[model samples]
Target chain A: MIEHIFPVHPAAIFILGALVIPLLKGRLKQIYLVTLPVVAFVNLLYLPHSVFWVHHIGGFELIFGRVDSMSLPFGYIFIIMAFLGALYAIHLKGSGEHVAAFILVGASLGAVFAGDYISLYLFLAMMTFSSAPLIFYRRRKSATGAGFRYIMFHLFGGSLLLAGIVLHYTFTGHTHFGPLESGGLYFYLVMIGFLVKAAVPPFHAWLSDAYPEGTATGSVFLSAFTTKVGVYVLIRAFAGADILIWLGAIMAVYGVVYAVIENDGRRLLAYHIISQVGYMVAGVGMGTQMAINGAIAHAFCHILYKALLFMGPGAVLYVTGKEKLTELGGLYKTMPITLILFMVGGLSISAVPLFNGFVSKSMIVAAAGLQGEAAVYILLVLASVGTFLHTCLKLPYYTFFARDAGIEAQEPPRNMLMSMGITAFLCLFIGIYPAILYNILPYPVDFVPYTIEKVVEKIALLSFTFLGFWLLKDKIAGQPTISLDTDWFYRKAGTAFMWFCRNPALAFAGWVDMTFARLAGGFLWFCRNPASALATGVDSMFAFVVRIFVGRQRHSPLRALKSVVGWMDRLSLAAEEAAKRRAQREKMAALAQGEVDVRGIDSALFLVALMLALFLLYLAVKYLW
Target chain B: MRYLNNSEKKRIVRYRKHLFYLGLLLLALLEIFIPRDPYFWFDGLPVFYSVFGLLGCILTIIICKTLGRYWLMKSEDYYEE
Candidate 1:
């Protein structure tokens, strides 16, 4: 009986589970949502390390299960985080959020395990669409617009990815997915698309803009999946691409710099997601065996800690209905547990000793040094300093320890705290004994991060960074303001486009319609109703000829008079024919309006003949053209 | 706010600062015995991480502050409004 149990794709469990959510209610829904991810995790363990559940579609293979070193770690963390996220969200009554989030989880896992470009593209596209409602479910006015922009960015990125996929299939005539060379326009297009999802720079604004607007639980789920999926794809496809090294280095620094001035606690953390992912990206870019392994390990650690960080602020928002650092203070006394848990997240992210970040981040930094990329090494180090300055010192100091804001708030619900506790424990565990994480890396375990010298160096750097914060305390204080970013371009441009569509474009279209109508009217008068026109034209010509020839000579005037009469006779025949056509049109309009008798035999036959003539003309033109 | 007396809370805050300062002093003192073998020669200098960490933090503040004053900072409703 056990031998006959077919291998199920891990993602299918959640996807099928998500479909049934709308039917369940209350505790039933909660149990179902929580069980879905657990079942998927179990299914993942049961599946062996080989492609399974392959199907033939057209000429391509659709691989639903491809378990390997690269995909397994991502699968493990994704499922684990989903379970924690579901627990955190267990108190919520909205079934829609659970459904959307579960499908998003399933789709992400599907993308991770997909063995072919077709399946990967399908899952990635699913990931894009299913995750959007997690933002929109907030149902706030700002959420509506932010959600729109978020999807717009993703759709645009999705289009680039789709274009690349189609082009790749056309150029290579292959559908299998694996490491791709950094060659040609299609590959780069695909990379850019991935970069956009990774929230790499100018493409990064959507993360900061939309993430903070999600429902508290939704934000935690979000912080775990989408960007990391992009990183996963990059690791699979574009390892060792030289451009990403520079890009990742820049991203590492860029995120921290922006984070320093950021005041919204959740949004501040959103920027740090970018900063932390920068390490993973830099690691993937370095492309050494240890570096790739480090990249995957860092991604694993980052998912746990970053979700914890987001959940902390999420808890604060849940309790106080406030997310701005400027509006929160002295939260430690009342929400002490939340504060401590949040600090674990903060410390882990800052790469303080005995945290997951310390173990994972050092591998990449060490790789950078070993690879002899001096500039990148320095910038990454600088970014680390900045990460501590913003996330660890500035954010915590202002939110928890600064002057009391006198707002009454307390700890969130039990499930929320438990969710955070799980993540926090993992962060500490991974830090203290990294072999658990290291053993799962794509490469064999070799790195050690806990040497005396390394620990001292970390402590010295962090200690001095804290000293710097103390020295510049006033200057780095949180304020009730926003820091503008690249998103300003689209926000303003969308408004301008709306304005153009409403006013100037409408007016121009109206003008063009009126001009076209007038031109048509003149042509109708000249061609169809020409009898009056011809008579008027003859009179005007006679008067003009008399004015010129009458004064010049008697013979010329007499000849002009005779010529006018002669031309009028020829025109009279044509005018008569035009008048007949005009009368026919009038009769047709009367019959259509029910004013004339279509019951008369002669009138009916005439109409039939005219229709036949017009049909023939149409056929002739069609064939000739 | 709920669990501690006012004086005790004040003491806790003061002690937190004192502990931070003591930790910094320990880091400074420990640098004397730390190994000099570093991947980069520049980072091999005594107290290199500390100096860089301090300078990097200060530089981040100054640069971000300047950016805020002149360009980046705006009313909280900058996007919404």
Candidate 2:
């Protein structure tokens, strides 16, 4: 290869492409589209392994604009992914989204090449805002919901990261992306923000929700770039942070759980993307040289294979317009190449002996083992089995080779097939000869992936898994069920509970006002009393003091106080007098409460009264302050 | 395809099952005799007493199958509402 300094000029070229794309509109858009990515890819291939560049924008020095071995692979993959994604989306018809996708990919690719903290931070934000429209690429009601949720969560992740960036910038004064001498709160806020993109457990709902619903071609763009870019950032910025080990472990297990429960074929694959990255994140957290190598290697493999998985299903969606697992089966009959490509993807992901996932994933697992993380090892292995369940066995069998569910999809378009074929071929290529990937690893490769002992271990495991699938294949009557994930807070319980507490109180007030309109009007006539109004909740301490000092009263104070006191006394005493009336009110409130026991007024009153007093006191303080 | 009596068919099934056990037995023998030096290139050679890898893999697959049966399925209209 020809040597040039900073050979991969990702930004200047791609930005020009993005700017011109919008202008090209409906014209010879294909020319600009093809030229931009091809040139970018060629430029990327020319760069030496790792070179740094610095540019000044106003006052910011932008310390790091370098590319190293670790980044070389990341940038190269994005370039390749962009090329493939562009080709796949060539027929997207509308020109705007195509431009947006290019900007999104280009910005993210540039962001990953960022050497210093400031450049990375700036481009990270750019990458986020750029990709928002892609979430709604299909533009349907479902897409709207999925896309809106996607934007909201990314916004949330962004806020956390911004907080970290602000804190770091404020304290350090030097925006450098390297080992932190001391990182307190800033590190954590930024980490959680990054983790959202990384799709760590509990924060991952936006991914499956947004991705599976994107346009047929939109998903191709979605898979190839950003999230793995997040993992790359995490490795660069916070390697060996200690907590990442457990965080990755949890992500690994959590990903497998959701993947297994998912019935939507595309959603299952989405879940696995996070799970596989979890292995890489955990490896980075291990902090050894070998571990870092493992993480980088795995991330590279993941981007390729994951794209394969998504493309396979997106191709299915392109042909038949269906994605639900139970609604599909035995598609191999019509789409033989698609089936085989999917199978190859599945095998690589399952980390079968001598496949793509086998090499990289085993590296992470072994690194965890050597690091003496017994629990992490066990969970990683369990996650491996789960990967086999959802991806390797479940995905292929259900989609391409199961009991005929009667949907015969034609082969996908040539470009789609070409893209899928390239990714699948890459999967096998990397698997059989991982040394090819290993040599480019930023770190020294002192690790081997395949041996008879290791091979036997992997085989025994896969065989046992084969037996598991054979045994459980009968009970495969699955449906598109929502598993209880961290999203329950926002989706079902949190949102519903807020409404549950709100609507009834509103309606009951409405009903009382409507039913007793005339009588209520009379009460206003008698007592729109200042004390009654002020003490409608709590008389402010300040107001009470002012009333004492000023001695100016707005209402018939004596009458109002006596009437309100009398009503309160009446309200408390009336409960004892009429059993049925008390029971009825309790029942009404119970409907709002979901289940507040009707029979337990005597005991419930003790805690209820105490809590009421505490709440009233809180209101008193709130008003006083 | 060979046509056999019912008893003969049963014997063949038994024989196939027995062969599986025989394969396992040979694998165990090979594990001991095999010095885990590079049967291929040198890196990532299996460190012996990696019994953890072997046993853990078996345990996990069984767990996945069980969970797959128990917890993995739901109705098609699950979140539609």
Please give the DockQ score of every candidate, comma-separated.
0.73, 0.19
Indicate which candidate wins on lDDT: 1
Instruction: Tell me which residue pairs clash in candidate 1.
Output: none
Candidate 2 regions exceeding 4 Å error are A1-8, A22-35, A48-53, A493-625, B1-33, B36-81
**Residue A328 in model 2: lDDT:** 85
Which candidate ranks first by TM-score, i.e. highest? 1
TM-score of each: 0.84, 0.75
Interface RMSD of 2: 5.7
Name the lDDT value of residue A595 in candidate 1: 39
Q: Which ten residues in a row have the lowest lDDT in candidate 2 chain A?
A: A1-10
